[model samples]
Target: MNLDPALRAILVCPQCRGDLTDDEAAGGESGLVCPACRLRYAVSDDGIPDMLVDDAQPLG
Candidate 1:
Protein backbone atom coordinates (compact mmCIF):
# COMPACT_ATOMS: atom_id res chain seq x y z
CA MET A 1 0.00 0.00 0.00
CA ASN A 2 2.20 2.77 -1.27
CA LEU A 3 -0.61 5.26 -1.94
CA ASP A 4 0.41 8.88 -1.49
CA PRO A 5 -1.17 10.59 1.50
CA ALA A 6 -2.17 13.60 -0.58
CA LEU A 7 -4.11 11.48 -3.02
CA ARG A 8 -5.67 9.33 -0.33
CA ALA A 9 -6.99 12.44 1.34
CA ILE A 10 -8.99 13.33 -1.76
CA LEU A 11 -10.34 9.84 -2.44
CA VAL A 12 -13.90 8.92 -1.60
CA CYS A 13 -16.23 6.02 -2.15
CA PRO A 14 -17.82 6.04 -5.54
CA GLN A 15 -20.97 4.53 -4.10
CA CYS A 16 -21.62 7.07 -1.39
CA ARG A 17 -18.91 9.65 -1.67
CA GLY A 18 -17.81 8.71 1.82
CA ASP A 19 -14.38 8.87 3.34
CA LEU A 20 -12.05 5.89 2.88
CA THR A 21 -9.51 4.31 5.15
CA ASP A 22 -6.51 2.13 4.44
CA ASP A 23 -7.41 -1.47 5.13
CA GLU A 24 -3.98 -3.06 5.11
CA ALA A 25 -4.77 -4.74 8.44
CA ALA A 26 -8.31 -5.59 7.40
CA GLY A 27 -9.50 -9.07 6.63
CA GLY A 28 -9.13 -10.52 3.13
CA GLU A 29 -6.95 -8.83 0.52
CA SER A 30 -5.84 -5.32 1.35
CA GLY A 31 -7.98 -2.43 0.07
CA LEU A 32 -9.42 0.97 0.84
CA VAL A 33 -12.56 0.63 2.94
CA CYS A 34 -15.71 2.69 2.97
CA PRO A 35 -17.34 1.86 6.29
CA ALA A 36 -20.64 3.50 5.49
CA CYS A 37 -21.17 1.32 2.47
CA ARG A 38 -19.25 -1.68 3.78
CA LEU A 39 -17.37 -1.76 0.52
CA ARG A 40 -13.71 -2.37 -0.15
CA TYR A 41 -12.10 -0.83 -3.19
CA ALA A 42 -9.16 -2.88 -4.35
CA VAL A 43 -5.72 -1.40 -4.67
CA SER A 44 -3.56 -2.71 -7.46
CA ASP A 45 0.02 -3.99 -7.03
CA ASP A 46 1.28 -0.69 -8.35
CA GLY A 47 -0.73 1.30 -5.79
CA ILE A 48 -3.59 2.28 -8.05
CA PRO A 49 -7.02 2.34 -6.46
CA ASP A 50 -9.86 0.61 -8.29
CA MET A 51 -12.70 2.98 -7.49
CA LEU A 52 -15.26 1.25 -9.63
CA VAL A 53 -18.41 0.45 -7.68
CA ASP A 54 -19.11 -2.47 -9.97
CA ASP A 55 -15.93 -4.19 -8.84
CA ALA A 56 -15.91 -3.27 -5.16
CA GLN A 57 -16.19 -6.13 -2.71
CA PRO A 58 -17.97 -6.27 0.58
CA LEU A 59 -15.81 -5.14 3.45
CA GLY A 60 -14.75 -7.81 5.83
Candidate 2:
Protein backbone atom coordinates (compact mmCIF):
# COMPACT_ATOMS: atom_id res chain seq x y z
CA MET A 1 0.00 0.00 0.00
CA ASN A 2 1.11 3.50 -0.80
CA LEU A 3 1.31 5.92 2.04
CA ASP A 4 -0.13 9.38 1.69
CA PRO A 5 2.45 12.16 1.62
CA ALA A 6 0.47 14.31 3.99
CA LEU A 7 0.17 11.51 6.55
CA ARG A 8 3.81 10.57 6.23
CA ALA A 9 4.90 14.12 6.96
CA ILE A 10 3.12 14.04 10.29
CA LEU A 11 3.69 10.48 11.48
CA VAL A 12 6.42 10.11 14.09
CA CYS A 13 8.10 7.21 15.81
CA PRO A 14 6.38 6.25 19.02
CA GLN A 15 9.62 5.40 20.76
CA CYS A 16 11.65 8.55 20.13
CA ARG A 17 9.07 10.75 18.51
CA GLY A 18 11.35 11.11 15.50
CA ASP A 19 10.51 11.46 11.85
CA LEU A 20 9.71 8.25 9.94
CA THR A 21 10.76 7.55 6.36
CA ASP A 22 9.50 4.97 3.94
CA ASP A 23 11.67 1.89 3.60
CA GLU A 24 9.55 0.07 1.07
CA ALA A 25 11.30 -2.69 -0.80
CA ALA A 26 11.01 -3.64 -4.49
CA GLY A 27 8.71 -6.56 -3.63
CA GLY A 28 5.98 -4.18 -2.36
CA GLU A 29 6.08 -4.64 1.43
CA SER A 30 6.44 -1.32 3.28
CA GLY A 31 7.88 -0.17 6.57
CA LEU A 32 8.43 3.11 8.33
CA VAL A 33 11.87 3.45 9.78
CA CYS A 34 12.86 5.90 12.49
CA PRO A 35 16.41 7.08 12.21
CA ALA A 36 16.70 8.15 15.82
CA CYS A 37 15.26 5.03 17.40
CA ARG A 38 16.48 2.56 14.82
CA LEU A 39 13.11 0.93 14.80
CA ARG A 40 10.99 -0.22 11.89
CA TYR A 41 7.24 -0.03 12.11
CA ALA A 42 5.39 -2.27 9.74
CA VAL A 43 2.65 -1.04 7.49
CA SER A 44 -0.49 -3.15 7.53
CA ASP A 45 -1.94 -4.96 4.54
CA ASP A 46 -4.85 -2.55 4.26
CA GLY A 47 -2.53 0.48 4.04
CA ILE A 48 -2.81 1.47 7.70
CA PRO A 49 0.46 1.97 9.52
CA ASP A 50 1.05 -0.01 12.70
CA MET A 51 2.83 2.66 14.67
CA LEU A 52 2.60 0.98 18.04
CA VAL A 53 5.94 0.90 19.81
CA ASP A 54 5.61 -2.64 21.09
CA ASP A 55 5.04 -3.93 17.58
CA ALA A 56 8.08 -2.23 16.03
CA GLN A 57 11.02 -4.26 14.80
CA PRO A 58 14.59 -3.47 15.78
CA LEU A 59 16.82 -2.15 13.03
CA GLY A 60 20.36 -3.34 12.70
TM-score of each: 0.83, 0.81
Per-model lDDT? 0.85, 0.84
Tens-digit lDDT string for candidate 2 (1-44): 56777887789988888888889855877999998888888887
**Tens-digit lDDT track of model 1 for 18-44:** 888888754545589999999888897
Most lDDT-accurate candidate: 1
Candidate 1 off by > 4 Å = 25-28
In model 2, the worst 10-residue window by lDDT is 1-10
Worst 10 residues of 1 by lDDT: 22-31
Give the clashing pairs for model 2. Answer: none
